[model samples]
Target: MASKLSTTPGEILREGQLEKRSDSLLQLWKKKRGVLTDDRLRLFSRSSERAKELRFHSILKVDCVEHTRKHVYFTIVTIDYKEIDFRCTEESCWNAFITLALIEYQNRRALEGFRRHRLLPIAYEEQEESEEPRSPSP
Candidate 1:
């Protein structure tokens, strides 16, 4: 069966606009919450703080990273300050690149810790995709 046509503006409004909004850097900047300047002394004193020697401004710079999924998976890219937290007064130079690098570095460290504790499994994924290329049959 064929789909019915929109007879009026009200009919079209029923489904709402079909357009998808593009994500922008400005949107990302605005979405950032909780200023990193709340409590400097307390933040620096945290034992989990990996940015002990590194200056907070130095961490403003970002390093590009790309990770491949073992299976078909969409990697979640988020800036979370759990292990390595840095706070700088330089709001003008809030380099997102450094944040990405810091997060990845922390992730690697966590993975290593898990391995040392025997928390990681040798074989994890059940549905392992074939890595061997299949030749076309005539």
Candidate 2:
């Protein structure tokens, strides 16, 4: 999967260690190095087999589940109801960066939709004007 990671073209928004919650009772956390892109967030472990990618569209919601003096914990809830935890120190603050990127992506999508809607009406009007015959000037 590491080879496939290079296939996606996007600016690196953030990169750091992200902890995955393994168990509820024990509250075990597994640290994974990750890089967050504009479209997706990819986490890589010691082995390529453990690589995981989380597409922005697949993310249903992102919430700051916990905040402490040392680190802030973020819970990224996916469409499939899978919750992934990421921890960032106060200096890095990856949580805010990810949230802002998601908001920007949504805004761009909305703007594209708006442009498409307006373009269709203008196109139809131009077509109608072009099809009509113009009267000869005296």
Candidate 3:
């Protein structure tokens, strides 16, 4: 999936049907149209109504919990430690796509932070040096 990773944010990475465990006491599995983007996973109902969104920034990790003859189950753990369950066909690889997109997004954020940190010290030193009195021009 790395080879297909889009550098542009908000681009659709993958789209397919995914079964998510509902929140009610019955915990029924509902089919959702899962749209994986560079930034978030948007789940829509059969009628095309927006259901739930799992944003990468809020997602802690995606865990593959179980596998059966026909489907693969996974859980998305959020930063607040809430776990959401989902399942899809093994061939669809929805879990893998979401995990890869999240990792790529996180890596990009870390790289940007590192770049900013590396430049900040140099910038600060330049400012300090300029503020210091010049030694009589050589």
TM-score of each: 0.22, 0.77, 0.90
- Sorted on lDDT, best first, the list reads 3, 2, 1
Task: Give me the runs in candidate 2 sitting further than 4 Å from their true place.
Answer: 1-9, 23-27, 133-138
Among the numbered candidates, top lDDT falls to 3
TM-score: the better of candidates 2 and 3: 3
Tell me the tens digit of each residue's lDDT in model 1 across 1-138: 122232232221111111111245442211122222211111122234332233332333332232233211111222343233222223222324234334444555567788866633434332233455679999
For candidate 2, lDDT tens digit of each residue in 63-134? 998889998888998889988777778777778877877776666677889999989999999999999999
Q: Point out where model 3 deviates above 4 Å.
A: 4-6
List candidate 1 segments past 4 Å from native.
1-52, 55-94, 119-138
Top TM-score model: 3
Which structure is stronger by lDDT: 1 or 2?
2
Which residue pairs in candidate 2 collide? Answer: none
lDDT of 3 by residue, 1-138 (tens): 765544676778899899999999999999999989888999999976856788899999999999999999999999999999999999999999998888888998898899899999999999999999878855
